[model samples]
Target: MEASPARRPHRLDPAGGCPHAVNARLLARGAVTPVELPGGIEGMAVLGHAALKEFLQHPEVAKNQRHFTALREGRIAAGWPLLTFATVQGMTTADGDDHRRLRSLAGRAFTPRRVEELRPRIERLVAELLDGLERAAEAGGGVADLRRHLALPLPMSVISELLGVDVEFRDRLHHLSSVVVATDTGPADAVAANRELVAVLGEIVAAKAARPGGDLTSALIAARDEGGDRLSHQELIGTLLLMIVAGHETTLNLITNAVRALCAHPGQLDLVRAGRASWADVVEETLRWDSPVSYFPFRYPVRDITVDGTLIPAGTPVLAGYSAAGRDPAAHGADAGRFDVTRPARPGSVRHLSLGHGTHYCLGAPLARLEATVALERLFTRFPGLGLGVPEAGLTPHAGFVGNSVHALPVLLRR
Candidate 1:
């Protein structure tokens, strides 16, 4: 009952349009390209790894809303205020001394010991989810929607439990968070979702304040930086919202993208299945080939700066094309687009920018990586006969300015 070689999942459709390809073409022309964002905001898209690293390290570049060119110009239109301001007070959007303070306090919550302690719990949750998937497949003609049954719920559950978010509120939170990141959401929907997200976060913050629990939310309620500065009420709500949303979104994409990459290349999957290539290798290669985050938005220059022979004026919004940098031919050579699990760790090869860089690098990286590695390995092992239930061309791409994920992965749990 094995799927034939010709039945393997293939690359995305040519007509569907790939943001990574667009960015790669831009990078090939030059390290920096003039790009326009929503609201008619003009900025330079930093393309290759060299330009991306330099852009991240540039002192003039800041992450706060006060410096957002589009917001400041009053051009940020409707349908985006949620994403623009959702994490406005969290470390994700803070810069300078404020960034350091927020990051330091949040960092304590994700220490090595804390993350390690959660591994057993994560594994248990994965097992429980897979058991449900198996049951669904058994009762429903051998098919399963891996995205919902496995990829989607695992990270959300892990993060929700980590933050002590009640199970009942999870579905609503997921909807709001999805709208915030989605570029294609309608204006009315975005506005309503934004309001609901803020209200929900406020409720959670108040509850945690009244009754401290053994959870990250409670810890953040009490968390203070080295300077004796604690998070404000707004900061607490923003930080918790950021943690809950970010904790799952990126990792969800990572798992989905990795699985799709493997299924698309049967030979590579065989290597992984045969134990020739490690799961860690699969994870790293996927990050390079199909980055979870397609591009990150709006880093404003504190002052005019020249990058890769291009001059970016002060306060100009600079967007980092992380997915494009991952496949930069100059950095990763001509075969950068090939999905190879056996790819060598060669010198001069471009290191992936999927997870950000420098001081503001993703804080939950370890937990994300661990969740992905465990999820993928256990998934394939539990369902060795898995194959695409829907054609590759039919799979829907994630509809967002950032994130490279499919809408759903309809998979055969058993051949």
Candidate 2:
């Protein structure tokens, strides 16, 4: 009688196209399908495992998302920058040699040793957060917002410490980032938030410049200084903004989404409760079942490219629907939509492109994995009685296609 986690709110609509659901039906019929977006813009949607995987690795598919040709030709309005394009000058937006250079510089912060060194600290943060959650539950008469107390704060604290961002400034950054990412935020508010965010990041950069500390921000400042015009001033600011926004938000989604998935699936939850499955299994399954990032925006093609039979014209914008890719039955078997922690590991298992594939892959992949693994393992192990406080349908979804997350995850921390 109860809803399954895989069948949670927003997973599908009456017409059967969930907010970010790929056209599985169309994919079955063909490799590429034509579709229209919100603004009457025509584009091509790549469906199924092979087409999507090939799309991701295709050289003709440009990562340069400026949509410069469209901007110049006036296809779409050059109005206030959307949340997905907020860091246009950052590494995510660069191409060719510029992309390689920026990625290399930022890659230093997430080396294997660096991520390994963060384990103990992350575990301590998780334990401390659990203690706070227990207290909050006691104070709330046995109910607490797990997302607010644990999911959101753990990554926020970790990222701030890593970047040397003063504790006082984090609340403001969180507020701004949320507004920027949400789709429902009005143009006026988005513009205002964007301005404030730019000003705040500018101040943080100046502070780091005056006295370079041993943080990532300081190291980036040194990188720019030593390069002698290699990294522009805008590039420096963009890189820092990229780190702050991408670093915490994605991990927050990962942690929160994993918890939600477990609470909705009792059989799978029981497996973990009985030690039949590890937390790593839960994390990977969640990433595949319901990706933290619903849809990665704006990958264009440099020239006309055909997938299956559909021809995606040159300079047209295409969205890599990893949210859809995760559920491709061709890639993960007929029951790909089902959530099962006991799914057997294969020699060459299908990889979920949630964190992305290719050169533009997430730089924070190792760090995000470390945080999620430690946080989830510690949370469940500490409070074996954790369960949802609210009904599955009552959870509020984030008002955007970019982030596949709910606004909050309320739970009974102990019962």
On TM-score, the leading prediction is 1
Q: Compose the digit string of candidate 2's lDDT tens values, residues 177-216.
A: 8777665566678778878988898889889999889998
Which digits, one per residue and each the tens of the lDDT, describe model 1 over residues 1-415? 2211211112222122357657766766777777655544565677787788889878778888777655676766766533454235788789878888778767876776888888899999999999998888887788777888888899899889888888888988988888876766667887888789989987887787788798888888776321256677677777877888789988888898888887778788899878899888898888888888776766778776777777777777676778888888877879988888888866853457788888888898888888888998999888777888788998988877566788888788863
Give candidate 2's error at residue 404 in angstroms.
0.5
Q: Tell me the spans in candidate 1 whose CA falls farther than 4 Å from its real position.
A: 1-17, 81-87, 224-228, 348-350
In model 1, how large is the Cα lDDT of residue 128?
98
Model 2: clashing residue pairs? none
Q: How many clashes (backbone N, Cα, C below 3 Å) per candidate?
A: 1, 0
Q: What's each prediction's TM-score?
A: 0.91, 0.90
For model 2, the superposed segments whose C-alpha errors exceed 4 Å read 1-31, 66-68, 78-87, 227-229, 345-349
- Taken over the whole model, the C-alpha lDDT of each candidate is 0.77, 0.75
Candidate 1 lowest-lDDT run of ten: 3-12
Q: Which pairs of residues collide in model 1?
A: 60-302
